[model samples]
Target: MPTAPAAEPVPSVPSPLIRAFPTAPPPDGLPAERESTAPAATGPASPGGDAARTAAPAVEDDADAARRAARAPGRREQRYQETRARIVDAAADLFADRGFDAVSVVEIAKRAGVVEKTVFNHFPMKEGLVFDADPPMREALLDAVRKRPSGESVSAAAGSFVVAAVGLLGAPEAAEGVARMARVIRGSRTLQVREREILGELTDSLAGLIAEETRAWPGQVEPWLAAHAVLGLYASLLELARDRVLAGVTGPELSGELRRQGRRGLALLQFGLAGYAKRR
Candidate 1:
């Protein structure tokens, strides 16, 4: 009985009705208020969401501007090329049909369907339109000389190049084109001087290449002298062909004449100047 008297009283349990319910739904669409008021939540709103939303339009605008910038140069280049080609084609046709001196820039512009100012933009002077026809050919010739075989001498390389160039001149339609150019050049003193200067520059470039190939001295006069001699012979033959065309030569007549002159020139160089070339 004494041990049973020490028994403790049982604790009372709370009623379930007193437990809290979720706070009233935020007024209409105010979710932010409900979230901020709720007990410490597991996850909160992203900190960068507002900044990202605000920056989206700027990023899109920048991307559009960058895309336009990239396309602008290509569009300009295409327009420039189209305008230039139209001018050159018109010039070639006019020069062939009416000769150089008889045609005017206004007439060329009309033929090309462009303003005279546009023609000047592509070619500063009228002569540039005629002379720049085959610029790539000059580059190709230089590349060929630079890439000649190891055993080929400079004279041999030059001879081969001359043969190839003569053949180009002799190709169908090429002779006719040359005749037209000769007429144009002969009619204009400005064109003749420009052409001679261009030829001189080409000769100098070729001489430099020969000097490089032979490892000749920097100030050596022989390479330049040889280049000038060879180029002079070739130029003289070109003038001969031009004179023949002026005198009514055409087709096989012109081709045979040009070939004969070219062979004679090469032979003279080979036999007469055999010992003059830079020994490799």
Candidate 2:
């Protein structure tokens, strides 16, 4: 009988929400700041081959050190994310319990088991903890538009992103968290203003992307118009989530409603709004 071969291991994929960005490569031949000003191994070999024996181990040590250095950034990033999640979770809990304005950043830092400066390092503004996930989402949404398949309209690409996002809220835990966040946002005027500002920023960014892709001339309204339509769908979906969550809808019921409404909203954008709400 012949022995069987071992199975190959599978590579791990990153979660969609917390994908890591690429770090810059380390500089060649040791960093100037870390390395000493010692001369290279250019002189002739020493008597008794002393330098040769020592040089081999030194080179080996350098290689080992380089390997460790290469892995350090990944470890650092993991720790950073872990700390950030702790802070955000603490803030969410506190905000849900005592309202957003009632909970101080100091209390959040204490609950998260980190110093105040550490909290500030992860989130420049207190509001940032509530919307920590926004930056990655913005990137993903824009990437969907930029990398849409041939023959796919921009609305379809943006719509797919929103629908998929809504699908993630199908989980009970996610729905609950969203409900909490929505309640917190409703209670705070600052949050409402921030939300509107974020929407405006997203609209501007999408408009700029559309203008670049379509090569629209200066003062072109088409790109801005299209951008507003797409982002308006996004805003509508957000409001739907807030409404459904508050209504005690959870799990599939909440997500299904969102996805269905999202599709219908996208259809409206695709087909134009001329026939909508006309007197009949």
Q: What is the lDDT for 237 in model 2?
A: 75
Error of 1 at 113 (Å): 3.4
Candidate lDDT scores, in order, read: 0.61, 0.67
Query: Which candidate has the top score in lDDT?
Result: 2
Which residue segments of model 1 deviate by more than 4 Å?
1-65, 212-219, 240-257, 275-280
Pick the TM-score winner: 2
The C-alpha TM-scores of every prediction are: 0.66, 0.71
lDDT of 2 by residue, 1-280 (tens): 2221111221211112222211222223332334433444444567857777668667766876887798778767867767777787788778888988999999999998999999999888887876533645677778877876666666666666766665555557666566777788889998788878877777888878878887789999877887788778777777777787788887888767777777777776657633322212
Please provide, for model 1 over 1-280, each residue's C-alpha lDDT reduced to its tens digit, 9 standing for 90 to 100.
Answer: 1110111111111101000111122223212211122232233336886666666666666766777678778767866766667777788788777777788999999988999998988788787777653343355445655765665445545654554455344444555556677777788777788778777877887788778766789899878876776677657766776677667776677667666666666666656445554334
- Residue 187 miss distance in model 2 (angstroms): 1.6
